[model samples]
Target: MDLLPLEVAKKVRRDSTLVKYTDGQFIQSRGDSKPGISIVRSGAANAGIIGMDGSVSMTTLLGPGQSFGEFTIFTELPRTHDVTAVGETEIYQMTATRFTRLYDNEPQLSRALLKTALMRSHILLEMLDAIRRLPIRERAARILQSMSHTAGNPNKLECRQSELAYTLGVSRISLNRGLKQLAELKLIELGYGEIRIPRPALLSDWVANHCNPAPLAS
Candidate 1:
């Protein structure tokens, strides 16, 4: 679905249920068939899968105005992943029944939402490909880049090293090493429990250079 710009908060605030979630709260759990469409008014969250062995494979970050749960809404299927609030978040939710009515009664709206969903699917596929081909450091940089919008301090990320280690499915030592490598390159700044990217463009450039150099065309 097309995300409403932050300016349209007034439009959504009236009809949608206003809900708040604290950092690390589960907004939706896997296997729940009742996921309603959520329109993010502010803050950020993440959607990811948890492996049987307890490893996490992050799918994507959802920021302000972005959305999650569209697939479940359209298919009536169990959710494939868990959505967790990355920070203090506020969202407006449209229940399954209301969304279903909109889908059935408004063909144009349905088509528009479907188009957005398809585009998101394509982006997720590309990200999965990147995760498969990229090194740990590149993956780390990508995550930091995604978090830039929600981070209170644009340069410093407000996430615990241990939690990130678990989410990335790497040993704390390994994650630290990856962070150290980026820090050494001056792409990121390391703090006690936070990581900083003084220049986000440089960080994005680091990932692009490491993982996706431009191809030469004849």
Candidate 2:
């Protein structure tokens, strides 16, 4: 639903070890078998894969208060993707045993995790639907809208054009073209490494108008 409940978060922090990383350092790797959950304490991380050709395919950005690796703890599986520090970053890491103990003692913790998993699934479904039915501009608009809504500041999104392009499964040139169109329409303003939505509602409205329509009568 929302970010992890404050009480549960406190408990997580209590049991976790504080870990720090510098810019571009890996917090976790794709095949690591360590079972633990990590919460962003400060700064940010990018969850993605670096291709053999050295291209990055970013899946999502994790800001402070976001927790990852829950599935890894539960399934005792290796990490699915690499999570790297965007800048200097701090993370709270709880081992599987400690997390399980906290989980057993806290009903709210379990519920919150379940909600987080469901929300992730819902977003994935929305992304797939958008990819199948929407154009690049509308897809960009929809994604930016979602990111801004989730961010602490609803009008600002901390993302790079390359990361956004990778998330959309588009080339940087194509994404730049779509983004420029949105800028021309005054829906967003692109900065060196961020996007500014002057009015988030306008972006949402534009996406709805362009991406959704009433079905024809049979």
Candidate 3:
């Protein structure tokens, strides 16, 4: 993915600075009245709604170079979900009014925002489909496939097991168990803060066969 351009930074009316967050910090919250857009400069954050039982069902994980909360620019509605930093993070932020003007004037910026939103929808559909049709084994395999696609590499990804568990809405121990099963099946190898999928096609087949055959359109 391309760096969110420095030129785009010029378009933002708010003075840009690095905002720091500790682990489990809520950068944005559900029902928040404020309207602002944030671009991730480093580290990780998740955006999603809270369930009836107060569990967070993450819609998407934002890593370096990703942005979120742009929908606030188009409407006065409160923030749709909480954005919490998973670890120490740095983000550049701007108010919704300025972001709206930028979106109207900059075609590339608009395209970038739309692309991120679409990708988030796709990931959410995959997660929901896994819950509906996949067993634990297939869920693990499919998660690997989806992450590989998002990372654009089966060989390299900067991820942590805790982050993966949060992204999947599962416990870390559960994720570890599922991952071990995949490793025994020769589907993937887990390393410190990363996973390597030697056989992405095979894993995709496992996902296609076991998970719901089609993703729901958003």
Candidate 4:
């Protein structure tokens, strides 16, 4: 992450609270956030909405510097997504009252939150567009490419393929098949609970080849 001015960072830091989460623990559940936003300081989290049928559809992973609960604070509504720690995770929490004070006194901090929300929206929209236009294989490739950036190690991403499948809204079988194909191509190395892209350039080429515009044939 790029450096922010000390004052701006300090303001967010002042209201921040820390919490350590164990595996399978909920950092923030759907309908849980009364107010305020939380940031991931360390470790990782899964963010998704729970379906009426009792299904949990993971939308994405939240890593360091990413914040959530903005919707609840902005709209004064219940939390929309359930955030859970995948492993032992640490987070910086802040209350809405505290956030309000900062926003009231410091317009810069307020604009920062707005900017963050807009960035998240753009990422969500891009994911939706890619999934809509491309096959699951290409989508999976792109997902892995994304993970590689956030992933702590190139050899092992903490998320399992099953969990990744849920996040991508693809069947486990399909994801497994795609992973196998990718492994066979030597583009990535797959594991029981992790993934590694040995050659990101190869995966990028795959996405470009599969998704780029092409001429119509007679």
The candidate that achieves the highest lDDT relative to the unseen native structure? 2
lDDT of 1: 0.70
- List, residue by residue over 1-218, the lDDT tens digit for candidate 1: 23334434344455469799998898888898885888666777667776688666666566666666777766778888887887788878878776666556546655556666786666555456555776788767766765564343467665667667676567889888989999999999988756778888888777767767469998
- Candidate 3 residue-wise lDDT, 1-218, digit = tens: 26346676565525455689987798988898787788777777766666677665555556766677777766778887878875688788877666667677777786677777787788778777876677666776777677666443455454667756766767889989998998898878889867788878877776676665667789
Sum up the clashes in candidate 4.
Answer: 0
The global Cα lDDT (0 to 1) of model 4 is 0.74
Q: Sort by TM-score, best first.
A: 2, 4, 1, 3
Using TM-score as the yardstick, the better of models 1 and 2 is 2
What overall lDDT goes with each candidate model? 0.70, 0.83, 0.71, 0.74
> How many residue pairs clash per model?
0, 0, 0, 0
Ranking by lDDT: 2, 4, 3, 1
lDDT of 2 by residue, 94-206 (tens): 89999999999989888888887897787677777777778899888877876664444567776789878887899999999999999999999999888899988888888
Off by over 4 Å in 3: 1-6, 9-15, 48-56, 147-176, 186-218
Where does model 4 exceed 4 Å of error? 1-3, 51-55, 146-156, 198-206, 212-218
Error of 2 at 59 (Å): 1.0
Model 1, position 81: C-alpha lDDT score: 86
Off by over 4 Å in 1: 1-11, 50-56, 101-119, 146-157, 162-169, 191-194, 213-218
